[model samples]
Target: MKAWFARDYGRPDVLRLEEVAKPVPKPGEILVKVHATTVNSGDRRIRACDLPPGMKTLGRLALGWSRPRQPVLGTELSGVVEAVGQGVTRFSPGEAVYAFPGGRMGAHAEYVLLKETGPVAHLPEGVDMQTGAALCFGGTTALTFLRRGAVRAGQSMLVLGGAGAVGSAMVQLGKLAGAHVAATTSAGNLDLVRAHGADTVIDYQKTDIARLAERFEVIADTVEAMDFATAQKLLTPNGRYLAIAGTLKEMLGSLRKGPEGKRMIAGPADERIEDIVELGRLAALGQYRPHIDKIYAFTDMPAAHAHVDTGRKRGSVVVQVAQ
Candidate 1:
């Protein structure tokens, strides 16, 4: 089987495409023939070994002390079941599926084996493989924020990086959750964010976003670029700040805000399988939609990684693996 591997953690150049042995599923797992996969922010952090403080420590344990402990570096996949391991009753051969695989993180290949119990689910009959793969990270993360935070319909919500994958997902899901969604993006991607139900768009380059304020009930720091002190003013009295890329500094300030549900800080583990399933259900029912920015060939995984590394991507970027 063909796969991409990184010998050591460094850059996109460290990743190389090669022929590797196909993996068989263990009991309670299913072997998938990967059709589509995505480049997540987490994948980029792992590729360069530039993880956050806590993640860096975990990298030493799960990845490697000096280099990558696990050579493969991709997550969130949409594929078809090639074979099911014993005791896996949810799917059968040829069934279409998409999964997060969480800590497993081996979706950048022709085949990956994952447990049926994780953030994995069956693709609705109408959804394509590419969109399916894109759902795990963006879908689950947004759901977690909306669910765990103090957001309600008719409230105002702002997504700092609204044009990117996770940000766009937040815009869409935020709207679906009945909030008046606002997003930040370059002037070039304003239409992209607005198309996904964003009621307000801020061209981050043109003006100071913090100054133009309607106090928000929920402010999601998906990009982590905005300073918490300034962002605090945008929140309503009982507002919540769910930082997708929050830091220890922000967490402490949020902690100071005390019980009003003002500071809700959490890690990337914010994604849950149930949350993703709920997003899927909403998508299936036409209450939600995925607006893909572009698709790249699977062989151009390196280039795709490089593009995202620029930190100026629009909406969701996907890699078509099988087609």
Candidate 2:
């Protein structure tokens, strides 16, 4: 099997494709011959050892001190089941599936092993492998935060950084939940954001968000650009502030009581089979389509990482791992 390995973190060039032994499924596990995977923001962060403020030591401890704990750096994948281990009756050889390993992080390869009961599900009919590979990370993250914020129909919701992968997902899910969605993005992505169902799109470069008089019942900051103070001012009373990307200080602030009934929601999103299943359902229904910015060949994964590092990618950057 061929896999991309990040032995040391620094630049995109650090990722090297090399021949590695194929993994065999253990008990209750299934081996997948990966067809497509994504190089998302999470991959870029891990590849560069980019940690939020005050989290470097903790990040190093969890990831690696001098090198990555897991050399393969992809988080989600879509593929065909090639083999199944003992007692794995949920899936069989030749079944198409998508799996979100999330922080487990070993999807950047020709083959991946997933537990039958993990965050793995069959690919919805008609959903291509690239789209399947792109769905989980952003979709699951958006769903988790929306649920945490208790977003409901008729309420106003604001999503900052609406052009990126997770941001776009948040906009779509928020609207699907019946909330009137407003999103912020660069001038270039105004149409893109609006196309994702945002009722109002604010051009961050042209309009200052701080000057806006409108307040939202739920404000999701996917760009880590909002401070608690700003969030407090922008949220209506009893509103929820979802810090989808927050600094370490803001993470600790999640423990502190907020003024009035407002609250801050910040933490890692849960990886659940149910969420993946729901995403598949939405895709099948044509209600949720993950935007793909580019597709790179497996051998060009390093270039994919470089593209994601630029911070301007409109959506998920997919890597075609197999034909």
Error of 1 at 308 (Å): 0.9
Candidate with top TM-score is 2
Lowest summed lDDT across 10 adjacent residues in model 2 is found at 248-257
lDDT of residue 250 for candidate 2: 72
Query: What local lDDT does model 1 show for residue 94?
Result: 90
What TM-score, computed on C-alpha atoms, does each candidate reach? 0.93, 0.99
Q: Model 1: clashing residue pairs?
A: 63-69, 163-315
User: Per-residue lDDT tens digits of candidate 2, residues 80-112?
Assistant: 999999999999999999999999989999999
Query: Per-residue CA lDDT of candidate 1, range 115-172, in tens?
Result: 7887778888787887788876777777877777857889899888888777888898
Off by over 4 Å in 1: 53-62, 252-254, 258-261
